[model samples]
Target chain A: MKFGIMVNEGPYTHQASDSAYNFVAAALEKGHEIYRIFFYHDGVNNGTRLTTPPQDDRNIVNRWSALAEKHEIDLVICVAAAQRRGIADADESKRNGKDADNIAPGFRISGLGQLLEASIQADRMVVFGD
Target chain B: MEEAGETKKIMYVNRKAPYGTIYALEALEVVLIGAAFEQDVYMMFLDDGVFQLKKEQDTKALGVKNFSPTYRALEMYDVEKIYVEKESMEVRGLTADDLIIPVEVKSNEEVTKMMTEMDVLLNF
Candidate 1:
């Protein structure tokens, strides 16, 4: 099955990110294809490169980035939501005159249209949030 | 149960009130955009979500744009399957008459059964 996952809350603040991660990992292990992973609202915070957790703690952002890299999954952060939360890519940073880009690896900033496309193409669209 | 090119049954479960947070408005935005896809869309008002359909909303005092009027425009998007939970309405001292648009008042059992038939379920 092809699955589209949507994360609507940031890490640490809610269990949504963790649950989505575990569900995706399990789905991949079973050889299912991930259509896309869309981050909206506070969920865009999961794509920031500035997060630095304690050495003993799990790095939520890095976990997502690594998983996305390994699986070659398209991790999309909503442009509107990302801008409001200050999650920017190189192009966005340059356009907005920001000093640097904070978008973590393996994640791309795009429009909500990507989300709608995912819903149409994927066999199932699952959302995790508050 | 979904096949390629098939129109999936998608349901947006609104469980929160409007204005207190952005969930209600954002969820509605998604619904509006999704109308273009021509899917079998359904909106369920559960818990405080029933408040979103309350009529005669005045947002001038709150200094926010009142989105209540947008509910009336949903019919234009071909999204007319709006369901309001009967228990949720009763608990809030509301009725179908209090809402801005016409909706089918469904009992909890009926709504729960309907949820099982959906291909995609989004809660806000």
Candidate 2:
């Protein structure tokens, strides 16, 4: 079945993000197709390339990046939320004249419309936040 | 008529003590994702949810800063229209004056009317 996952919680605090990650992995391992992952609000923090967990802690950002690289999943962040929080892609950073882009690869900036569209198209929209 | 394009309206209700548990924060997480999908998103807090509306929550002893500060920022994301049940406030020993932020306070009938209006209800 096709799945659309949504992550709303920030990585540093709650287990929502972690649960979402594990659920995505489990779906892929079960031979399911992950349509896309829509990050909004604080969930945008998970897509930040600048996120560096402590040496002893799990690096969630890098883990997401590697997962995307391996599975070719579409990881999208809400641009409105991202920019407000100072997380931008290369083009956004260049367009805004920021020092650097903190958005990770395989993840693009998207709007709520995309998430709406995915929810409409996918077989089941399985949300992972809260 | 409910059109095929019309998504289900799900309210991510938050009614819990903010510090002792992760329910309130978790509720916001759900709302964010629901908003990302542009679904008919709405959040309501009744009963203990009023505790979450309190502005200053110093959780330093637990090695955590006040995460309640983020609630104020939620409005900027177009997440306005948070509702509070007035009866829950009174029953829980809270008044409108005790709450930190401004919320749309409603009676039990009003809250029931709004909640029943939803097609899919998810509680956390």
Candidate 3:
């Protein structure tokens, strides 16, 4: 089955990110295709490449990036939410005339329409949040 | 109105109130977008979520935009299956008449059954 995941909270602050990560990993292990992972609200924080956690700590952003790279899944962050939270890609930074782009690898910034499309195309859309 | 694609049963569960957080408004935005998708969409108001449908919401004093009127527009978007939990309403002292839009009052058991049948469940 094709599964669409929606993460609504950032890492560390809430278990939403961890739960979504584990759910996706489990889904992949079960041989299901991930349609996409739409990050909205504080969930966009998961796409920032600037997070510098302790060497002993698990890097949530890198973990998502690695998983996306391995599975070739589309990791989408809502442009509206990302902008509000300062998570931007190279294109977005250039468009907005910002000095730097902090979007992590394997994640693309897009509109909420991607989320709607995922809901329509995927067999199930699972949302994780507070 | 024409259906955009294969129809899916989608439910938006509102468990929080409006104004205190952005969940209520953002969830409404998703519903509006779902309108264009032409899916079998349903909105359930339970717990503090019942407050979202309450009538005469005044946000002026709070200095925020009043989003209550947007609920009325859902009808135009073909999102007509709005359900309010009966027990939640009674507990909150809200009746169907207290809401801005007309809704089908349902018990928690009925709502849970409906949830089990949905293809997608979005909670806010």
In candidate 2, how many Å is residue B64 off?
21
lDDT tens readout by residue for model 1, A1-130? 9999999999989999999999999999999999999999899999998999899989999999999999999999999888888999999999989999999999999987777778878888999999
Error of 1 at A13 (Å): 0.4
lDDT of 3 at A5: 93
After superposing candidate 3, which stretches have Cα over 4 Å from the reference? B1-4
Clashes by residue pair, model 2: none
Fold similarity of candidate 1's chain A to the true chain A, as a TM-score: 0.98
Select the stronger candidate by DockQ from 1 and 3.
3
TM-score of each: 0.92, 0.60, 0.93
lDDT of 2 at B42: 67
Answer with 1 or 2, whichever has the higher TM-score: 1
Candidate 1 chain A, run of 10 with poorest lDDT: A111-120
- Residue-level lDDT tens digits of model 2 in A72-102: 9999997867777788988889988999998
Give chain B TM-scores in order: 0.95, 0.84, 0.95
Candidate 1, chain B, TM-score (2 decimals): 0.95
Ranking by TM-score: 3, 1, 2
Q: What is the interface RMSD of candidate 3, in Å?
A: 2.4
